[model samples]
Target: MTRHTLSVKSLRTTMADRRAARRSRQSLERQLASYTSESDRIELDAILSRHSGAEANELRSIINRQAMDRLIRTGA
Candidate 1:
């Protein structure tokens, strides 16, 4: 409709997308934590803790990949 209304709608959509991404990231982190040992989980949490914004998501993806790789190699 109006320009202002369109801008508001876009902002709301962007916020929703960010929230959904955050939830997905959290779920992935939880799954990764479950797959690792306590010491490794602590290290993973430390790595996962130091990042925020876009880098946080990227770091989480990297951690997930690494965990999967370890599991594959270990056959665990």
Candidate 2:
């Protein structure tokens, strides 16, 4: 049997786990602008999932959903 001891070193528990990035108001607008077509919209939505844990996500969801509803109703 062999036993070994290592020297003490600085370590961070969170260094390996990546935190989801927080999006700013301007960043959200830029993201919105990137969507031009239905395919683009789907891609944008996939990318959006990363930073949507914040309070603003609900607001944007409500607003965009309403806009989509209006467009469908108007048939335009």
Candidate 3:
């Protein structure tokens, strides 16, 4: 597989992992109900948000590079 393929696969996995973590955190929040402290929820949200954002940026970079490659190959 191309390195690009590997990167996209990795990005997909990272996104999946981020989804699972956020879901788990949300479930925890629901379970806590009136018992949840604000700090704990904020921490969980922050962690997931950072990871998801980084993965998205990486994917965007990869996609842009691929697009540029196509343009150059076509002499455009």
Arrange candidates, best TM-score first.
1, 3, 2
Q: After best superposition, candidate 1 residue 9: deviation in angstroms?
A: 0.1
Per-model root-mean-square deviation over C-alphas: 8.7, 11.7, 17.5
Residue 6 miss distance in model 1 (angstroms): 0.2
lDDT of 3 by residue, 1-76 (tens): 9999999999999999999988985675445443234475465446555666765554445444555665688897
lDDT of each: 0.79, 0.55, 0.62
Angstrom error of the Cα, residue 71, model 1: value is: 20
How would you order the candidates by lDDT, starting with the best? 1, 3, 2
Error of 3 at 31 (Å): 0.3
Q: Show the lowest summed lDDT stretch of 10 residues, model 3.
A: 29-38
- Model 3 residue 23 CA deviation in Å: 0.3
After superposing candidate 3 on the true structure, give the runs of residues whose Cα lies further than 4 Å from its correct spot.
Answer: 34-76
Poorly placed runs, candidate 1 (over 4 Å)? 38-76
Model 1 clash pairs?
Answer: none
